[model samples]
Target: MESLKNLKVGVIGLAKSGLAAANFARSSGASVFVTESKQRAECAVFLKRLAKGVTAEFGAHSDRILESDIIVRSPGVPNNLRVLVQAKRSGIPVYSEIEFASRYISPREIIAITGTNGKTTTTSLVSDIFKTAGRKTVTAGNIGSPLADCVKKITPRTSVVLEVSSYQLEDVERFRPTISAILNITPDHIEHHKTMRGYIDAKARVFENQKKTDFCVLNYDDKKVRALKSLCGAKVIFFSAQRRLASGVFYSNGSIVVKLPFAGYSIALKLKIPGRHNIENALAAAAIAAAAGIKRGAIEKAINGFRGVEHRIEFTAAINGVEYINDSKATNVDSTLVALKAFEKPVWLILGGRDKGAPYRPLGSQIKKKVKAILLIGEAAAKIRKEFSGTAELLDAGDIDGALSLASRRAVKGDIVLLSPACASFDQFDNYEHRGRYFKNAVLKMKKRFEKK
Candidate 1:
């Protein structure tokens, strides 16, 4: 194997992926240079902290970047960008971090999970299920540790459970997963992919390099995911919460039942997580687990004990007889719809963030029926207010703290103050987790202050 020794690699965009690429290139004995569009004080401060050997130029320096042998395209940078175009014209190879990283590490078994929603939940659940079955499993890629970092530790017995994003899957070459899952495809990341079809195509690449011997677990309930049946070379296993399956997992009379081909008995299983979306997630996890040769009993045990991921319909605290729920992970309209469905009481929804280019009409209708009041904040606040004007009482808060204050004051007994932002968290916080933590902390402060009163 020819190591990427003394190779000149240029990283475009100074986001997490870009930084990871820079670090990876440095480790591989390559000289790294990073370029960013912003030359702000914050960016300058950040660039100053990079390795002394690594060089960085900010504010539209395409010429400096175009000189490198290989360009590591960060997910945030669009393909149509002038810098990428110049690199292409120069005949310089451009690859995503995942594609670049795959050249170094050798991993036998990879389980890649991609979807518009439930990717994190399914990936975490699948990894947990494999762990319960006493397998040496590590969950990485798009979730926490980058795939490159995780791949460096892969062994013969290690099963890599990767939560792949559309961006990561977009440029994969020979990076095939032994077990691939397309949980569901909805219109998401439109701002990045620029089109719904493009987003779907990026997700579909999870199975592009997979072999016939590999397994592709798909959501039978989602029509878009169901359409990929013909495209997948891997053996198809369907999972549904709404429909019954002859050889997969389904919901029957309030219990999850699985009917496998090898063992044709339906086991009445209990799930610790709430909501129909989670049931579908469990089914997906079970399908992956079963395909990985995990026993049914182990799957059931893991499902029974798994407490669900944080920031997804997470309960914060009850203050003044009102329940505060943090669902900052619902960054898209479809996810927010799921969160809205999970609630029975009148909801005081805290919505709005960096818009993902999804229409809010469907969400407006749901708010008209279910939501009592909405406290809007961040970049999409105006757009959200306009969309839900006649349907619900929309209040603009301008910030997360203001939203929390208004929501707490407006929420009545038995009513829910839900922070289910139907947009990306980039405008208000670091990410969804950061947004969720702030909401939780605000709720806690409000609880304590009310108690003192």
Candidate 2:
């Protein structure tokens, strides 16, 4: 490993990834300084975990950060932040935590997954497939753990399965993965990236550094994703849930069929996860595992055993034959559409959160066809209500609690009460996970009350 001795590093944000980056840099012999926009009280828990000899500042980014040789930014920090822009102008390099961590780990294969949705599930599934094949693997990046924390501890044989985000990809430089997969892209995160094209550009960066020897996995069902194949320098492998592929992985009838130039394999579908989106996710995972040299049987076994991830269409409970689903991770219109498509039962969908610059108009037809009611919550409730006012039974439910309470009263047998907010949860809760958990706990609490009755 190259020594970071005598180097000074500045880390922005004090969230999970930021703290990990600060600690990792300090341990790597770099003089680390951590800065966060949140006050000391807000970041107390994380600050307590900061490594010894690492100095920190809270509530602002100071000139101290500008003095560092390089700046490592958390995903939460905006790329165009004044301090970061100034640092770039001053000739100091700025990188996302993933990029910084990638510099230290060489000769280890990385399977990076990115898309508007299904990143976590696909990443976890890929990691599970690798483990089932008896390979050492670490799943990190946007799926909660930072790559920085995983790098030093991982051996040369370890396979890194990363759940990358557009934010993380925005600053990547010289960070090349052995294999990269773009599950599917839709109109999301436009608020941060400023335009749909900008969001697509950032997602495309996942495979930008790959060479002919590397593998790029493309989603054949998505035109935007399929077109990206031409931009990739690596050997392209297409995976599809919509059509059969003669040269890549695809879902055919009731099985996942793999048709590589060298060999062919197929696995029958017996997934515990619901939705066509998950079938796509499984296909993507299988493609990545196959590209990594994992056997088809191991890939099939892992895919069959995988149950799904939390906060993304997770089934909470069924009280009085009414099901409650927590899909708080559906923080965009496309995701909520996927949730709606997963169910045949009449849905009492709890929609709205902090708007992410996407419109709710696209959900109108689905809501009219499949929804019993629309319970609006969070900051985007008004905007959603405006677009969907007459499409279904509209409820001005203030938040998750109100939405669940209203749904419990109105929903009947065989109906679904879904918390699939088509917007970010920042306005109401800490994050999507917190929002999902709160919805789930409230549902469970209501279920217990039903038992007493």
Candidate 3:
């Protein structure tokens, strides 16, 4: 591990990852100074970090922070931020919170999962498998708690299942996983990454530091993820949702199955999570488990009983035969599109939130087929209306409650009301989970009102 003693480190942004990075740095004896772009009034969380005796600057990052030996930033903060760029020009290295955390933790196997959709599902499924096999494991990273927060949980017998993202991967210099999986790459976070090429490059970084002995799992059905075999030195393992592979896992005849050199197993569709996408996630998890030498029985037991992560297509309520689904976790176009594919019933889709650079045009055809009508809200509403002008019946419902109200009036008994906003939730709520819970609460109120009639 590199010595942090007496080194001056600049931590940019006071978000969860940044706070973790600062605390870890200070604990390691580094002279840590924190800078946040958000104002002091907005940083109640920052004050808690400041109580630890670390110096901090809020509202704007100062030019003086460039004097540090290195800079570590939150994943939500763009690397091209003026202060970070200035640090780069000054010859000081900039690192991701994940990268900095890896240095302090003991060497252990890391199974990192990343994709446009299904990251949390795959990461949690893999973690379940490892834990069920009686192996010690910690789940963190982009899924919920930052990797830096959970690194201390790692020990010689323990493993980490991390849900990484393009944002986190972009800053990684040597953040190699013992086994890494690229679930699938679709058009996402274009506003932050700038281009599809840039986004793909960032996702591919999970495999950048892998050795020939390491394993890189991939989605064979996704051409982009399939082609990633050429980008890394790690031994590649492909998992498919389509036809059976010679070596990897595949969905066949309503069952999840895999064929590898060690042993092969067929997992009946026992996962409580409904959808073809979840099946693919199960297969991906199985591939990671097989690579890690976890027994087939243990892998099968954990995955079959795995219900799923909350907020991603979570069922909220049923009122007068109409089902409500809170998929507020669908913060990107592809994610909403995938959620739409999971159901065959006519859908009343609630779409909108803070715009985050996802192109909405590709959703036109899918929206036409699956969605009966759309209730729009938040900053992305106007842009979505323009892109999907004639795709479906589009209505401007002012907010989450407004959208739920419209769905109650417009949706038929057999129809599904799906809250699958193809944009981030920052405009109307704290995050996707908050947006999802709020939607669920609204539906519960709607259910109570309907029952009283």
Candidate 4:
């Protein structure tokens, strides 16, 4: 591992990842300086979390940031930020927190997963599979905590499971994982990447640095993800949810079959997580575990016992015979489509948040067929309403609270009230987790009110 002794490091954005990076750098003997665009009062909590010697400037990115030898940018910060662009021109290296953290971890097997959807679920499953196989495992990256926070705990025997986003993968130079997987590439995050090709290119970077000895797990069902095989230097192992694969992991009949060189077995699809998307996610995890030389029994046992991560089509409560499903992690059009197909019951779907430049028109058919009403919320409400005005009943509830209140009144017995927003939650709450917790809490409160009635 490279030493950070006396290194002058600048951290951008004061979010969870940025704070972790600053602290990690400071503890490593680096002279760390943080810069956040939000005001001092706005980022007061994050400021309080900073390490003792770390200095920071809030409300702006001054010329002071340009003085550092290296810059560690948080995933939420745009790559094209003026200072970052200037830093690139000045020859001072700019790296994502994931890339910066990877430099500190040595002799560890890193398993990195990326895609528009199912990254968190697949990452969790992979971590659990590794742990079940008796390997020391740590889960981080885009799954709430930064990899920097857990790098100190990563020994030679450690298996690091990372849920890397396209944002995290953007600035990585030599950040290669021992086992890298691309679950599925859908049209999401266009607002940041600007185009479909740019977004795919960013996700593709996860495997760009892997050598021939490394492993690349891919989703064969997603044609976009499948087409990326030629670009990868790692040994490609494709996993499919749709058809039987001659090699790698695939779903055949009612079982998830693995046909890798190291292991071969089939486990029945008895996962707690619903939907074909999760089947793909499980297959991806199984393929990753198989590549890492984990035993068939451990993979099967982990897949079966995994209850799934929160906010991805999580069942919140059943009130007055109406079941509430919180899928606040469905922050894209394709994800919301997966959530809709996961259920057969009539759904009162809560849709819209901060728009990501993807059209809501693709969701029209599903809304017409399954959704009883489309409850609009956040900034994209008008755009969503315009697309599905005549396709289904549209309710402009404005936000999550109003949507739940309206759905509680209109939703009938045996129907589902699904919180599948199909857009980013930044408009309403801090993040998707916050939005999901709020919805789940509201549903529980609604249940109490129903009992009183």
Best by lDDT: 4
Candidate 3 scores a C-alpha RMSD against the true structure in Å of: 1.5
Q: Give one digit per residue, the lDDT tens place, for model 1 in 318-395.
A: 988899999999999999999998888999898999999988887866787789888899999988888777888888
lDDT of 1 at 278: 88
lDDT of 4 by residue, 320-389 (tens): 8899999999999999999999999999999989999999888888888899999899999999888887
Query: Which digits, one per residue and each the tens of the lDDT, describe model 3 over residues 1-453?
Result: 678899998888887788888887787788889898888888885576653757888888789789899889888787678988878887898989888888767746888999999999899899999999998888889887887777667787779889998988888888889999999999889889889999999999999999999999999999999998988899998999888888888899988787987768787767788888998899899999999998888988998899888898999899989999989889998888889888999999999999988788877877888889989999999998998887899999989889888888878889999999999998878789889889888899989998999
Pairs with backbone N, CA or C atoms under 3 Å apart (clashes), candidate 1: none
* Candidate that beats the other on TM-score, 1 or 2, i.e. the better one: 2
Evaluate residue 152 in candidate 2 and report its C-alpha lDDT on the 0 to 100 scale: 73
Reference-based lDDT, each prediction: 0.84, 0.90, 0.87, 0.91
Model 3 C-alpha lDDT versus the unseen true structure: 0.87
lDDT of 4: 0.91
Each candidate's TM vs. the true structure?
Answer: 0.94, 0.98, 0.96, 0.98
Q: Which pairs, if any, clash in model 4?
A: none
> Candidate 1: global Cα-lDDT?
0.84
lDDT of 2 by residue, 1-453 (tens): 567787999999988888998999899889999988888998888877889999998888888899999899898687788999899999998999899998888646988999999999999899889999998888899996899988777878888889999999988998899999999999998889999899999999999999999999999989999999889999999998888877999998899999998548899999998998999999999889889888888998999999999888899999999999999999999999999999999999998889999888988878988999889898998888788766898999998889888988888999999999999999988889889889888989999999999
Error of 2 at 403 (Å): 1.0
Q: RMSDs, each prediction?
A: 2.0, 1.1, 1.5, 1.0
